[model samples]
Target: MAILIDENSKVVVQGITGREGQFHALRNRDYGTKIVAGTRPGKGGEQVESIPIFNTVQEAIDETGANVALTFVPPAFAKDAVLEAAYADCQLIVCITEGIPAKDEAEMYNLIKNNTKSKLLGPNCPGLISPGKSNVGIMPHEITLPGNVGVVSRSGTLTYQAVHELTQLNIGQSTCIGIGGDPVPGMSFIDILKEYQEDEETNAIVMIGEIGGTAEEEAAEYIKNNITKPVVSYIAGVTAPPGKKMGHAGAIVSGNKGTAKAKMEALEEAGVLVVSNPTKIGKAVKEVI
Candidate 1:
């Protein structure tokens, strides 16, 4: 059982006319996701192979019942693309574009978070996948093996590495989600954690976070109180200097807050097994499970 998506999800690519959009949407569709329709204003009435393209998301949804939306537009248009999908009521809206303004990210988050229409995944994310069930975004499907472990990560690179390592160790995952490293990402660690906690097929959890925000610390607190599942965690940017932004826009450290050490301490206090080395993520999950 996957947390958010599975064989039942029907997807619509918002920027399907673009190169990246066409590539991933087709890749995902070929991988078994039901890519029912696509949306690109002037390219309406066209086709990305067999899938139909509509002028608007609502048209796509109304025509094909596409419940999931993935956006692969440029940074400047990301906010509008996402808001359009949200208004069209895509059950799950995934924004794969990076470099969106923080204010724009916040606006989308606030509006969507307040609405019951959509559950937004990311604005700079790799999207998510339920191996053998469905694949969305750019994460390769070959590295995954279907099983029970549920993975949630802030870093897309770490998410892939963790999944690959787990598969190498013969540990299959039920679902793997890269929630993106943007400062104002639509979803948080706690959101995915809650879903994992409620998912009956999920027996253990692997949470990967990085330096930047108190999200990891907040998730630690949530795990302390609400989740009873065994958890393994890895926080990146351990040696990063204060006031310097790392690879991610949100990966910044100020004073004592948002440091890797601080996040590690918080998770440890909540009884989570914290691994200092990123390479040990698979081993950590193996032990916990």
Candidate 2:
């Protein structure tokens, strides 16, 4: 089965009165996700595309039995929004806000890890799509297909590119998760890797990483010991200079650590097929499986 979300998920959009919240929520609904409820501080009793709006997450859940929360709140209020979802016991919380403070994100991440049963996807991620089943965030569903390849990525753009290429090669995916590229994303590469390894529908995996974090290296260690599926990987920012901050806040090289070379080398040593060129990632996956 698909990881994280599926056709049965009933979603509540936090800050659903906002432009981004309305657009993506309705779009995901059109993609067949259950966009059942929405939360706005004072916009209760309103409706966006017939999705009922409530004053709070708990209210939405009480009214619609919403098990998933998609957040489009501003950076300043992102942590509060996530907390609301977590405390409401939403099974899956996908936060799409990108400019949240690192401290705020870390606090939210830790609380979800230690105190709540809710699984948080991202604070700056593009959310996920279980193709032909559900779409929960801003990703274009046209580029995906229902198949056995599970994809996880740190970059939203790269996730789309990898999925597009895989679909082009006629290899569809089971579920694709953009775990976000924030310095303190709620979910990690290792976490999603475990889910992918356990997902029966997933026969292979594609991972898109960016330079500037030790996450890929950590995932490599876990994959070596745990995962049996063929995994193809591409690390972006290969040419980024040390101390240079790349597009994403987490994508920066420090001294000899967090370099693309180091991440690629680690994954290669772990028996993962690491592709040097991002464009050839789909080909690499095809070769392995």
**Best model number under lDDT:** 2
| Number of colliding residue pairs in each model | 0, 0
Candidate 2 lDDT at 138 equals: 92
* Tens digits of per-residue lDDT for model 2, 179-281: 9999998889999999999999999999998888799999999999999999999999887778877778888798768888999999999899988887787
Ten-residue region with minimum lDDT total, candidate 2: 238-247
After aligning candidate 2 to the native by TM-score, how far in Å is the CA of 289 from where it should be? Answer: 1.7
- Clashing residue pairs, candidate 2? none
Candidate 2's error at 256, in angstroms? Answer: 1.6
lDDT of 2 at 51: 88
Please give each candidate's TM-score: 0.98, 0.98
Once superposed on the true structure, which residue ranges of model 1 sit more than 4 Å away at CA?
none
Q: List pairs with backbone clashes in candidate 1.
A: none
Scored by Cα lDDT, where does model 1 land?
A: 0.91
Task: Point to the candidate with the largest TM-score.
Answer: 2
Off by over 4 Å in 2: none
Model 2, residue 98: what's the lDDT?
88
lDDT of each: 0.91, 0.92
